[model samples]
Target chain A: MGNIFRFIARYHLFLLFAVFQSVALVLTFSNRSYHRSWFWNTTQEGTATILEAYTAAEEYVHLRKTNRALAEENARLRGLVEDSKYIGTVKRGGRKDTLQQYTYTAAHVINISFHKRNNYITIDRGFLHGIKPGQGVICPTGVVGVVNQVSRHYSSVIPLLHSRTRLSGSMSKTKHFGSVIWQGGNHRRAQMLDVPRQANIQLGDWVVSDTRSAMFPSGLRIGKVAAFSLDPESQSYVVDVRLSVDFASLQMVYVIDNLLKKEQVRLEESSAQEPE
Target chain B: MRHPLSALLWSIVALFFQVFVLGNVQLFGYLNPYLYPIIFILWPLSWNRATGLIVAFLMGFTIDFFEHSGGLQASAATLLFMIRPWIVRAVAPRSEMESMPLTLQAMGQPKFLTYTGMSLLIFHLWLFWWEAFDFFELFSILFRSILSAGVATVLVYTIQLFSLKSE
Candidate 1:
């Protein structure tokens, strides 16, 4: 034991360096998909508080633009209010399915990075505000990201700009679906892969959320086709999409609450587990 | 030579500056100038290596927390600290290194720039490659690292020069 102590004392600097390096690397690789370490991210209250304060101070310069966006969103919501829906028939006897499968909770983005190799967003809403991992985040214009981790008062979002982010997107005109992915260069652009070559894809054609995505509601706009070409290897069209949500200027967003997501996931899991 | 408390204060200032200011400034949509490595680069040569490594880890971790970049910067910074002594030895004259204080003034401007620039480039290469986590985009990683390291070197060297002038 004394010999071991002497050896350690001799090479203590290298040992310390190794220990610190390994810890940092482990933290890096382990939490690639999502933030596993709770206290070491922007979701932590102290970091979030600082970010929120900075955003608050920075909000003034963008107030006019943000207010304009809010006004447009409010107008759009006003058109869908209860009074706007006309009642054609009143049926008192039949059982009505009134449960909403999805709901929305508004939140403000406190910190965000669109120019990193792997980007993330932090919102003011958290577990206390009913935010949870796997929930979709969308702005008034289009899809933003998905919540990856949650703390008490803030949550981290794996934004669409991240390399690991893959969202189910479909052509609005033809309904053919593909996976949208960011290739780590431009913030306003993403690539939609696995699109069928035969699908009638045109420049400026809209891509929206597919029916199969549990995170997002159907018809939520993702982007528009900026360019496309056939991949000879995969025999599929790889489309460049111009993302609708301008990530640089994004602030306000809504966290999607898929009320029936648990039921749907359970059913799918059970069916998959059964023998084919 | 910097007092230990003063060094600590500079590290804190660099951390916050990197997190709040440089973190947001990405030139041409991709290259982010990481000025946090300045803290590690300017570490006092006479200080305990273990303490320097610890400080490097903590500073890197704090920057990661602010940027939400999982341990990417921390690992890169720690790796730089581990190799820093050798880098210093390689750049500076042995006699001067032993006798003189290892600051910009003692080393003169050109040698100091060489040391700082080389260290910054290697650190950024490690950081960007690890960030990519794959060798498929080797050119992209190299391009980003070189450009960003160039920018960071200028910024850090300018800051060092200003501090030297003030002192």
Candidate 2:
């Protein structure tokens, strides 16, 4: 008994090291996924408050640019409204009500990081603003990310710059679809994998979100194809696309609220649960 | 010897700088220069080992909290704290370490560089290793670790130089 006590007393530091190291390692590995505990995320009250205040201060510097973007978006929206009125007046038959498939909620980007393998953006809108996880986020130029987690007053989005983020993209001209994925180390570009070689893909072709996407509405702009090469093993084109959204300069964004998302998710989950 | 409160105050300053300032400075995509480990490196030699470890843990935890990095920084900093005493003993004689601040002025440039380089290397290696977390990209992990460590070492030295000049 005395010998055991001596051994433990002599190696107490080592034992303490082991205990602390294990705790840290566990936290590191467990929190890699988007579904990490809210307690450790930026949405935690103290961290969120600090980041929010910092972003509020920084927003002053970019106010003019943000106002310009907002003005341009408003002009485009007005043009669309005029075009819709012309179409309504020209129609001979009784008025056909257009279904609104998606709603957009404006939010302020409180904090963002594009340098990490899995980058995330925090927006000021949260559950209070009807924001939910798995909803898409976008700016005036193009798609930005998907909401990954939400707290009471803030939400974190997993942007396309993240290595783990994968979205379904389609060529605007040919409608050939591929998987757009970020291959860490670059913020301006992402790769569209599994595109067929004979799809007539061309340089500068526009890539947009496909109809099969659950997070984003079909036809939302993603990027332009910057480069392409055939994969020898898969015999498919690995296309590099230049993202349209300037992640670094992002300030104001819109979170998409898919009204039918719950129904779609339920249907998909049920189908997936069936045995082969 | 500096008072414990002063050490505590310096630690808070370093932690704030790391989270608010250095955390945002990413160069060439993967090189994040972490200068917070300097807090542990400069911890008083005469401080209790358990107290030092606790301080290291808290410092790391606070940084991680701000960065939303889970515990990557925390684990790396704690490991550095655990091995710091041995590293100090290995680099300097016992008599020279009595209440001496771990800085270039006190320990000479070469010895201080060696001590900082070794500890920072270990800290960065563990940090990027867990960050990548995959053996498949062995070369990338090694490159990131070395590059980041190099940048961080230079930055820490520059900070030390400026502080000495101010003094």
Candidate 3:
């Protein structure tokens, strides 16, 4: 009716604002719930191209630091070469065998954000380059993040500093397992929860990735325990860890492809289906 | 004064500056100066309110696309546009009412700064609050809003100064 038209004309601005805000809210809440819109993220070809161009322009400013980090990483990798080691563990007379369960794909970081609560990192490698969602990523020094979404030429990573990131970590010395989670203020720190009170723990003790998770290789360095205290309610220690990777200056990383991931998942599902 | 083409141009320039340049600057790990709000602040007063809202929404969505942040920017920008008219009316002198353009040179420095500064503060508070939503660090949020507003105010004013034609 004309009355409805008059009402709409009178409050059209407000209506438009409400509609826009609602749409925005939908995008935000859905993204928070991990149902990210495919077209909005940096994976979009145009956005990725712009970011890559900006990174290229800024590359020189970080060249020295990048070179130094790469050099240190190279030195570490050099020590792992076959020529540097003798047969420390002599194999008894048995069938000679070797198993390869992981592959590393080198990728350049195109864009990254560490200041936000729900930060994401965009890398140059994508599906075409064998990057896939849920694959773990690591830098030369330590674990970085896990791939969240992939496009043809780029992928976004959910960095460890993000609030939603829950990485399984363990005390290197005692092998006590805990869940490492970022509490959303500091980029350099995360908290490890559910560590039993009886476990022998110490300040500066290394916290490495737990082998129980197939996403990451066992024993990759995550961080070191900075502080710890007994939780009155859970009767467990809440330990604070200083993350090893400096997300601010991270430039290069490797996407880890767990070759046996599918097999492990299938086997676990099959066993679960059996009656308890 | 309400040239749609010019508005479009300004929107593109501001979006480019915000995503490509200012996005990189994060002082003390939290304070990120945002200059895109200047688009709404200086928008011609005679422009259609509905058009302005639509423009604000699209501009915000574009920024969100580049930042990889979902709808935080879009919502905040919409809210900013909604309140912009009131801020301008409040800070502008009665004598300046006839001037449709809300420019720094037209309103003078004090009123211009107050108008833009208020809008930037509200915009940033809305943005950082939702961004650090789960953290519940209100002190940090307030600090970020005030500090970033100050920096964004300076940057916006500087851009205006450069564009102003000397008499």
Ten-residue segment with the worst summed lDDT in candidate 2 chain B?
B63-72
Q: Tell me the tens digit of each residue's lDDT in model 2 across A139-234.
A: 988899888878778888889987568899999999988999987676888999999887899999999996576777888789999999999999
Highest TM-score scorer:
1
Error of 3 at B14 (Å): 1.3
The runs of at least 3 residues in candidate 2 whose Cα sits more than 4 Å from the true structure, single-residue gaps closed, are A1-7, A32-43, A79-91, A94-97, B89-100
- Whose lDDT is higher: candidate 2's or candidate 3's? 3
lDDT of 3 at B147: 89
Better of 1 and 2 by DockQ: 1
Q: Quick one: best DockQ, which candidate?
A: 1
Regions of model 3 farther than 4 Å from truth: A32-43, A81-91, A267-276, B90-100, B161-167
Model 3 C-alpha lDDT per residue in residues B60-139, reported as the tens digit of each score: 99888777777889999999999987887788766666555788887788988899899999999998888877456788
Candidate 1 deviant stretches above 4 angstroms? A32-43, A79-98
Which of the two candidates, 1 or 3, achieves a greater TM-score against the reference? 1
- Checking candidate 3 for backbone clashes, the offending pairs are none
TM-score of 3: 0.89
lDDT of 2 by residue, B95-164 (tens): 8777778888899898998899888888988887787677766777677778877887888789889988
User: What's the fnat for candidate 2, on a 0 to 1 scale?
Assistant: 0.53
